[model samples]
Target chain A: MTPASPAEPTNPPLTRRARRRNQLVAVTGLVLVWVLLWGSFTWANLIGGLLVAVVLLTVFPLPPVTFAGRIRPVPLARFWSRFLRDLVVASVQIAWLALRFGHTPRSAIIAVPLRVNTDLNLTLTAEALSLVPGSLILEADRRTGTLYVHVLGVRTLDEVQRFRRDVLDLEARIVAAIGSSEERRRVTGADPAGPPEPTRLEGTPT
Target chain B: MTLDAVLDIVAAGCLIAGALLSLAAGVALIRFPDLLSRMHAAAKPQVLGLLLVLLGCALRLRTGVDITTLVLVGVFQLATAPVAAHMVGRVAYPHDEIRRDLLLTDELAAHIDRIRADRTDRPEVSDAASAPGRG
Candidate 1:
């Protein structure tokens, strides 16, 4: 029998203390990232990243804390391996393009379809993809499961086709690494090559 | 003078120019009475200003990796900012708070029928449809 779809809850509530704790964690994480990246205890960069994160959270609030659906913790070792591999691949691609194609290369904007759901997963996917040199996520239509991306140094239609396939593969690995166990079961069944199927989530078609 | 000193001077100059331009753009945002003008102010100098800042960063960094990262960031910002601004204007133009008196013509209103036909998902009252109504 097909598993019963998880029912959506409206306004998943968070305790006041939980909210404060989350904010603290977020701030701490930001400081750590800043120090790691800059290799110095620069208060300026730390504060700047914090402010940006705050603005982002204010503009886009988190999905309500729903009891029905659970987030899967990324397997740290696996996630690191895949992330590093992609980073290396992207850097090499960019370097190759710079050497061969000069600064301005023929580029196109294409939308690739994916199976991932949830704002957080989609966002993390986009950010990860964007760190790659030759490709950047322009926008993601979460409702449609499509990501608009700008790719550098494409010469022909065949290249575009390969690029599209590469994006799909990248997204699949990301989803596999980050998706909940239930999401893995649901998405693996859906054909990633085809048009997105309707989400089984209980929300009104958002 | 040492290479570091020379690099520092160039970086400082670029940083100063970038800061001034950004400051000008911020002032214009407050000073301008209309949305379009404010955007015009924002787009021109601020973008160039940001480029200068990136250049400054690249100059200051003695290592190749830092320079590469700064350049990549600059390129990404350049590519993304206009798209974001366009999207913002697309959403914001429909709002009543935008001053209509300052506009010459609202092209969105002229093409409202076509736009509505194109995007059935969006409300007819959205900024994309109301572009021409500002005049």
Candidate 2:
């Protein structure tokens, strides 16, 4: 009950400097994409790619995902290493589940209310969770900053609870890697009120 | 053996592993009972499988331009696969497509009513305009 914040974090007001930086980031990424797509980086390619990036950005405005945090090399490296390992492990588990006979895999839908309810945090957490394991993003409630994850194969209530905890843990790791300093405290300090109690259910089905 | 020969051997192994994962995904598609499960099964393996296959391809090519193209494919797949899965999963839920009996617990059910209410309350915020009969 205490996990999610009472109010969602509104998008931070962007200064002119912030807006320019965001545009610069977008332009650089897009140009790199164009160059890579062309499979060469000659002067002609560089100039052409820049033109294309500008045109594309002008035509289709991008979403305002305020990146308020700086990348920490140590934590970023940790995130990548862990992500690659989980990708392999999850693939193996899913493969085994599919190949095995007789057992019908039990699934559950778990609502994981995030600790830091920023749009950036919510989006990254959802994306990472879907990739890492038996979890899939069913729906992400932006208003409440909750992610409803459909997890494959959980035979009991304990497993369900464990998965929820894992989700929170994953969210924390994500924040550590790239969340703002203020947001990082929310993870490090954790919920001030208390540990999250199990969400009340409509009826515990047998 | 030479370096090229050893690299070729590793590349072949990656290709084989990717193929096996893809096969597993196909098997799950048929064996899984419902739309949600099948969609989940069909999509997840293919992601890692595609990455492995691309890695093999990059190793075999061993050229800058080609490797960048392979990298692009991997990047795009990583970005888009989860989004595609999410789209399918949301539609599968609250419908006959989900084998409700097989679901151990549906935490979403508790919040479904309020979610629907919000959707109807602010149709602009939702994709309700895209619903077949309405728009």
Per-residue C-alpha lDDT of model 2 across residues B2-77, encoded as one tens digit per residue: 9999999999999999999999989888888777777667567888999999999999999999998999999998
lDDT of 2 by residue, A35-136 (tens): 998898899999998999888877765555677889899998898899888888887878888888998998888788787787788888888787877889
**A1-206, model 1: which lDDT tens digit per residue?**
11112312122245566556666666676555555456555678788778877776566544333222344455545665776565445444443433442233444445555555555556656655564434555445534445555554566656766776776666656656656566566556655545432222222111
Which stretches of candidate 2 lie above 4 Å from their native place?
A1-7, A202-206, B116-135
Model 2 clash number: 0
- Give fnat of each prediction, in order: 0.00, 0.53
Chain B TM-score, candidate 1? Answer: 0.78
- Return the DockQ of model 1: 0.04
Q: Is the docking of candidate 2 incorrect, acceptable, medium or high quality?
A: acceptable
Q: Pick the candidate with the highest lDDT.
A: 2
True A-B contacts kept by model 2: 0.53
The best candidate in terms of TM-score:
2
What is the C-alpha interface RMSD of model 1? 16.7
In model 2, what are the clashing residue pairs, if there are any? none
